[model samples]
Target chain A: MRPTVHHVAEEAGVSLATVDRVLNRRPGVRAKTVTRVNEAIAKLGYVRDISAANLAKQRVYNLVFIIPEGPNSFMLGLESELGQAKLYSALERINLDILKVRAFDSDALANVLDGLDLTQISGVALVATESHRVQGALARLRQANIPVVTLVSDVSAAHRDHYVGIDNVAAGRTAASLMGRFVGHKPGKIALLAGSMLVRDHVERRIGFEQVISAEFPELDCLTVQEGRDDAMVTRSVLADFLGREPGIVGLYSIGAGNRGVIDVLTSKPEYGSIAVVAHELTEHSKRALREGVFDAVINQDAGHEVRSAIRLLKASIDETQVIAKQEIIRIEIYIRDNLP
Target chain B: MRPTVHHVAEEAGVSLATVDRVLNRRPGVRAKTVTRVNEAIAKLGYVRDISAANLAKQRVYNLVFIIPEGPNSFMLGLESELGQAKLYSALERINLDILKVRAFDSDALANVLDGLDLTQISGVALVATESHRVQGALARLRQANIPVVTLVSDVSAAHRDHYVGIDNVAAGRTAASLMGRFVGHKPGKIALLAGSMLVRDHVERRIGFEQVISAEFPELDCLTVQEGRDDAMVTRSVLADFLGREPGIVGLYSIGAGNRGVIDVLTSKPEYGSIAVVAHELTEHSKRALREGVFDAVINQDAGHEVRSAIRLLKASIDETQVIAKQEIIRIEIYIRDNLP
Candidate 1:
């Protein structure tokens, strides 16, 4: 007994073709006609059968996910999740394409973004590299009325419609708090490790970490940040040298990828095992590190959640629908040895 | 063009009626015919247009959410989420009915379960109270081929199709780990609070908490549990009396509700402010306590996530469809001052 398009058309005294145009937001319907149809729909309590409408129209959203190409386990996992989402692409009427650019290369990322054909692409999600060129590309997409969601790392906020990731500042603050508590009152020096200062997430994390350490943990002091560029070998060499030089280091905070290097350094050196370590992201390396007591805590943002949230946001924007705000807030997940999953 | 029902019928060498019967799992179709139809579907890669199929069949799922009625903030939050879900009922074709019974009253819960008209109900979800009477009712529902999902709390494993909540044991273990670390190496007693040992989640949490405390924290001892029945007034009186007598208590683990009372007692008595407190669920009271440094950490299973997961599980069960396992996992979230959200 639910009201349908036919009921709305009958109530509005409009032709079926005009009702279809109004319902689909298609051009050719006059503003007055659209208003009349909408009023009729409201009056009749007509709930559009979205499935049938899509079926008749054969509407398929073509979305692109752009990410850095590298051995970063987190990004790889995200790529896998996107692949899994493709399994439902037929059912959801979505066509997903992934574009990979060199890691941390703003020029490459910008070129890829600028080259995208707006006509072929309905939406875009990217792990943005912060730069004016990239921002300009995002703004162009926005100008073309294409929805854009920034995943993981974000550029200028104004260019993106939504950001599907955790608050990096809060994540860093949480890590600092956990590091402070785990190290206790006898903390001497805390070693800071990051991917790069150029990356906005890393910079934001460093800001928050320094803010907490200086304000709360007066006994502890952070050593100079070592930018490992998220390369495992480079990170391993850098950490080894840093720890060797820093004698009074009582704690370590790995604020980005390259946890493997941190774990390697901690596990190989028995003395450093007692140094309370906090890291970001949950990977095979981090999980093992947590279990073996090398890493005291891990701050994680679920990649699966980010990928799915981006898809949902893009779809909602395309459909002009409201998403559940509470559900979309990606939580900063904290994990220890006891609660791994 | 996407394959239609007519295409499926033609490929299966059957009538459209037979294909419909097979797809909907209705009676009158032979097992051989069902297999043929399924094989044809697979061969043609015919993804079912679930929304269209549901619309065509006018399939409105009638689901019942049976939860304990009380002043418990967590339960109230869950109820509110259910109410929010009602907004999408027409679009999703789900009729959700909430049935509330007295909190912790096994007889009342069992009677309500037994009284449900099975013919009219598509699925059931409940915050279970462990008891033989309730188990029998669940068994009867299973016998009648009804899908049941346990929310927040779970009963015996065999009775429910899915559990849309975090692992209570792991949650308890995580709490103990945090408590032990936060309390440090100082030798003191850790007071344990519970709603009741009759509830399965509470009992399991206690068991896990004890296991970790005994195995790891040799300096700390858990005092006898104090059941407050999750009532603010009763918890206030019990905690006041308990803290007065238990002078050496350095940490408090609240395994269940009544956190408002815990907050009131801790804030009122400045002496108890230094005590490392860990409690379950995130509410206004818990958020305030966390922000004020009255509670060190909060172990939360998001009520919104649990409700959405339960609904998804129920619908998937009704439709005989697969659910994304990762999306359904209710993570044991650890909240601190820095990561309040």
Candidate 2:
């Protein structure tokens, strides 16, 4: 049988109500008292009796995911996954509000965030930028003692509580390893494609890719990266021009979305499909290309996990508990034509 | 702002006590009164404020997951994912008990189910089989009005509340498409290896594979099915023998677990490394093989999602409500070298 609140109270040598206050995060409990209660909790291995604690606290965290207003397949997939996650548990208990804003416009994000009822809003989870207005808003939220979490685009330097996505560097390394091995002992040039170099994920991925490929597979020369801004037209034009210049293009590593654009150009010009191609995000277009042998592998971070993990982290920040990192560390999926899940 | 109990009572033309009784599923409410309350609920769009409702009821659902005891990497991963999920919202309010039993042992499973307390255990979720004893226990639970949800391997014969997992047949078809596309324009033979023919997923996958490959990629000859019984040694030996008999094996599809064994044999043989190897469940071995150019692609199901989904389904089943099938349906994840997320 699990230990009850009464047992914890007795062990802590505190009154039942005082223990309740500490456990429920009620006001007027000193830090010392809270610490003692927590010590008792740890000693007893008392997994928080959430149902009983919730009964007393009735904490319905009003959460908001400030999604970017872009047609980025990954972000769209994230939004859809979040909406679907609502059907998972007692989601009605959550007052979830999705605040969609421009993907790269920090001013727009700050403007919208400033207008929300911060007191009533328990936490905020968003893909953010490192701008003054954003930092100021975060500071304000911190002053108000509200929890803040970042999604795909992390703002951990802002002292955010947790990050709930894949390690972009590891993903990049994995990509390089595949890019090196899959070309089958061929000494040729590999081209890397990215949306933008500014975003931390893309930057980290490129670094990892370069580091691995250079150290292990030196025979393959990695060309300079081309920025497509995740746009199909830009990708198509840029890739077409690059292919024309470099005839020995043996492999392609895409660090971001613009897969549809790449696929269109790859299949249209007969040589691209036969060459080893890799990209990110398993969208409708990517899935099709993977099936039809245009793209070789898709390194993906389960958008659903990211959404759910961000929520959990936000809630944890509000609650101030240590979250296990390994469980939340998202994996990079490797896809070939034969074993696409 | 959402409607309150008072508003619901007013809308239903009932008293506060009656509304409480109906909402709480108390025994005293009349059938006609319940119907009226339900009508009012629908009319007001009174989504039960779940946090507050849980607070008022102080109900802690004791949910159980009866997983089969096998050394399958997939099952271990499922358990690990379960451990991770426990840190989130589910553990706070729900008491989860995982009872590991031997797979394909209907008698033991039925016996175990018989002794359980439905009153205390609000819901039950398991990988069930079609058996008289198991059915009898489920019938008893139904009589007692307990919710029983089926997980990955569901017993459709038993009227369980919900099923929480992926469409294996569709996954198989997707795998087939990938295989057909990746091994394009090459004169090659493929092999379908499975754990057991009796398992629903393996059977369905075989059907789906045959369905797609025959119609789309007629040039690729999918060879006969082989069962490993999910045993490592058996799989390694069987695959090794099969390779001796069949020479032009260009494609390999491992439909189920015991992948380490497959990798061991395949990686040891220099001839097998060049073959397009596709398999299910991403384990340490698979990750290594992909890196070293042994395995090509890995199809995965997020065990965590499936476990969490099962628990939610069980809880919802106890309430006798509709579940969003789209949300519950776990997706098929395709992994390759380039986009390995």
Candidate 3:
């Protein structure tokens, strides 16, 4: 005779939901209760007909990824990975919906978040802009029983279930360390480039970079950061002007997506070959730059990793399952010319 | 009326097995066939209750992890992660069995592989010793339709389905670059330490370290590798002897375990502060060393990541499913004191 879930529940002296949660690997059930349920099943010699059970329930996770619409290679890569994830919907049982909002526009992001029908979307994964409006929207989603996970740049104010990205502060420290090591105690001015101070990631990176550089390489002077809004032309123009003003700058740390601009400026002045340059994101431009010796190192977080991690986290949240923390950590990868891949 | 598997098969002009293959996300079906089947299902408005279907099948994967028994923190970490994975088997439908062979013993590993009951075990993940005997055993497993995935140290000669570890060459190159950059242009000899050259990972790392050091930092002379067999006491004795013999050695690249031994040698001689040290695996000893400024850098591959990856890869192989390549590529992580975990 086939032992049913009811039998196991009765033997375990637990509710049906508890048994189901244990069976489904969902969180919320106590470890002792889970053990009891398993022991009861073992005693009954119960074998789960997983296919029939899943077919009976017809579980499908309706997940949405809110990405900032941009020409940035990193964002594009994220979108591409999401598309790939969507293609595996049959296996994952995920209905992945992608929404693109205005990049860096908090109002636009908030509106999108507020507009989401929680009944329709079981989970939301977004590259959030940290703002009061965004926070309010995320709080609303949480209240409505919808899980929200922040990606790439995290939002502290939001009720986000998890953050699927690297530590920006650590990333910055790594950049500074690389710059210090590459420059080799040579007393020279170091230039810092960023998109803006509005984003938490950029701000944290700036703070971390400053902390490391000031402590370790006091001989080298790190100048004030120049915000180029991550625009290539703006970055190029600003960097060119800065380079002209500070010809003594022997190291450059571009901790943003405006690497093309940095590369353009560096390419125009080939005579500054000795300048040790480190940038963020391994985009096509940066990869090429690393190969050509325009950039000494690129501190990158794989966009694919971020997107997949967000999806996994959101799905786990939806399933009420515990995700392996170590598996979910997006690494701050350092790439040099020799080890590009 | 809902569509059934028969309807899908008829619509796609394929067999029931082909439809099942496509529906199960198995690898054997052609892409065009899968697309046709999927299109047919969509056209017929077919919705599969995947959980119920899987439940009906009652599929359970009996997998094994073959690890080396040692006090080495990295190996212990791997075992711990595997234990965690086993705890989640109720959800993954995996019956995980762990087999610990004698450390670094090719014959012991080969015997274990040869002894596996293919009828009971669906897949195997092993920290393989690269030997002809092991390869032959792996070939037998393949012949019996049992999938094998090599973890940590890989065996290229085996008929293993996949290797779930980072590129050792890239890791060694990264270590060398960090050591070279950290040491600057200071002219001094660098000592290389390893467990054994017999393992593919150590040999590859040695080659990569040598390649980068010779090409980029010709000023720093990297010495021949001293095999310590990964035993702490042996590593300590060998390193102590080497330090005594070459007092001018300014850099140490310990490409294997036995970091504790290295730390012991370094701790005794406080004047070796100028010596740039780079080692692999982030363990308690190494982490403490990094924090104390005794070690400059640690190249680590997450044990949890490796275990989970090996399981995923093996499971996919057992299911004959396609895996996302980018997700499967284990990263070569470079850890400084600033960015630990």
Candidate 4:
């Protein structure tokens, strides 16, 4: 028995239009409703015949991707992927509309969500939040038939259709394992540079990082986490202050953006023989630092894949296409100087 | 006046159907024709009116990404992106048909290219080679009006519409900078590992690495370049031999695939306390070694973005749409344990 749209709508306790929106990831649905519908779909295991379904529907699947706004290497990388995607847009059968949002603005995001054109977009892929209005708006959109896929961060209350990014906690664990291995059962002072606690991705990453550090690298004492907020200025100040004060710090882990500051602190003044440094995102700043021997390691998630994946899922919903689950998963990339592929 | 496909075809000296095929990235035609068409398009600066063209034509963009085969983590990551793209395909108003070819076989790829249904697809994206057949096939497609974008390693001879990925030379330079900085201005021996010299990306990376090392890292001596061909056994044996002979080797720069053997060799006896290591791609082998500290850094290019970008460009050709250049570029991602986002 094939699971029809009517069945999905009935299971989700929504109207037919609502099901259409949810499946297609259309705008104007509440987050809560979207989750309920997704939950229903997961339970039903509904799959569509993409080619036939799309041919019948005119195949207009418009999805939006909201990325954090910053000049940091990671954001820059994300921007590059998005630009490339636009150059060779993956979905000609559907429409992928992109909207870039400024980072750390909950109210602004809420206001934007309130005013988004519901008729045009099918779904959204965004770095998430824990705000009520955000959740409420998503719920409304869901009721209206729009689906949402969280990127980089999870929006738990909204319960979006899917998440198209890496597992930060696992990435953290991987980071810890690397730190343990490279440092080798030796005890030393390690400093951590975090971007911000405002974003869910950063917070989760920190949690996972701390967990791994506690379990594996206990011999190495960790310095207090510095809030860089992905700013070069703040990162420079924080790192400069730490390096000056804690000359004994032999290892460093910067979980935030803006490696230019770290590079400045490490290479500008006279330094010791060796200090193990690890950070995230392979931006120009970080990459240059790695080449210069200032940064030790970089852990990364490809922003381009996440963007493309989010759009594809939105289209599948709208087109009623069969999507293969095994291929959509995103993984973490770990970088070192020797193996820079 | 806006340049049209007609202008491009006339400039390229091909038939209207060939121009249409090239503009739409449709299959068929010979490789030489495709190149001539591309050159014509370049000469005429004929950009498609993607939105209107797509709305009018109802075109479907199908892109094929040929990556190295087997359980390579990076390749798997690319595969995952393809899967996810299928799920959210509705948003982009297109369809992506992805096929994975065996690794390191230019002839095998040429064979696969020969079997493609040119009329059905809008374009083709491949990690290419300078093979005669591959070029001929591409030329024919161009003549038929099918847009071909090279993924990862490019096909300059094929005159691909675009190369949707990072600059390997820059990546190598970046790697060298990191290696120099991490090792400090100390005299030490460094080992180099790679998959093959057949790849332009690898060659460029090696050149960049050597260029920087010789120019800047006078104290840090590079032993020699070893070709592993992305083979695990070969890398393990090579690394073991290198480690045994070069006891003073304090650094490793793997510019290729198959790092597991290297990891296994390094971790077997635990002589990895101060051996600074750098590699490319964040695979299971690299990830495990990174966690264990057998490796120090990784340099990565997002395969997902490249695949998606290629598909989008193809679709745009079919739809005759405008592609935003800023959105589709793939960037390098550097990872460290602390900032594993």
Which tens-of-lDDT digit does each residue in A1-341 have in candidate 2?
A: 56788889999999999988987768988898899889999998887655555545666778888888777788889889878765553443566788898767889988887888887898888887657898788778777888888787777566465666677888888788767766755699999899988778899899989988999789999999998888788888998888889888899999988887898889887767668887888788898898787887777777877877777777768766767565466767665554454
What does candidate 4 score on TM? 0.61
Q: Pick the candidate with the highest TM-score.
A: 1
- TM-score for candidate 2, please give it: 0.80
Calculate each model's fnat, 2 decimals: 0.62, 0.31, 0.58, 0.08
**Candidate 2: count of backbone clashes, pairs at least 3 residues apart or interchain:** 20
Compared with the true structure, what per-residue lDDT tens digits does model 1 show for residues B1-341?
67888899999999999998987778998898899999999888887787677757788889999999989889989999999987776577888999999998989999999999999999999999878899999999988889999999888799899988989999999999999999887899999999988888998899889999999998999999999998888898999899999899999999999899999888887789889999999999999999999999999999988888898999999888888889999999999999988
Local error of candidate 1 at residue B164 (angstroms): 1.0
Calculate DockQ per candidate and list them: 0.70, 0.24, 0.46, 0.10
Candidate 3 versus truth, CA RMSD in Å, comes to: 4.4
Mark the regions of model 1 whose C-alpha exceeds 4 Å error after superposition.
A13-17, A27-34, B6-18, B25-36
Model 4: residues with Cα > 4 Å off, grouped in runs: A1-128, A131-153, A163-202, A209-221, A225-341, B1-127, B131-146, B164-166, B174-187, B229-243, B258-277, B280-308, B324-328, B331-341
Candidate 1 local distance difference test against the native: 0.90
lDDT, model 2, position A234: 87
User: lDDT per residue, candidate 4, B182-287, as tens digits?
Assistant: 6656688988888888888888888888888999888888877888778788888888887888877777888988777778777776675677777888766676
* Candidate 3 per-residue C-alpha lDDT over A92-173 given as tens digits, one digit per residue, 9 for 90 to 100: 5778999999888999999999888888888999998878898999999999888888899888834788888889999999
TM-score for each predicted model, relative to the true structure: 0.97, 0.80, 0.90, 0.61
Q: Write the per-residue lDDT of candidate 4 for residues A45-104, one digit (tens) a residue.
A: 775544445445555556677776777877777777777676455435445565666777
Interface RMSD of each: 1.2, 5.0, 3.2, 7.5
lDDT by residue for model 3 over B219-330, one digit each (tens)?
9898889998887999999999988898788899999998899999998977777789999999999999999999998988878878888888887787666778887877
Q: Candidate order by lDDT, highest to lowest?
A: 1, 3, 2, 4
Residue A248, model 3, lDDT: 86
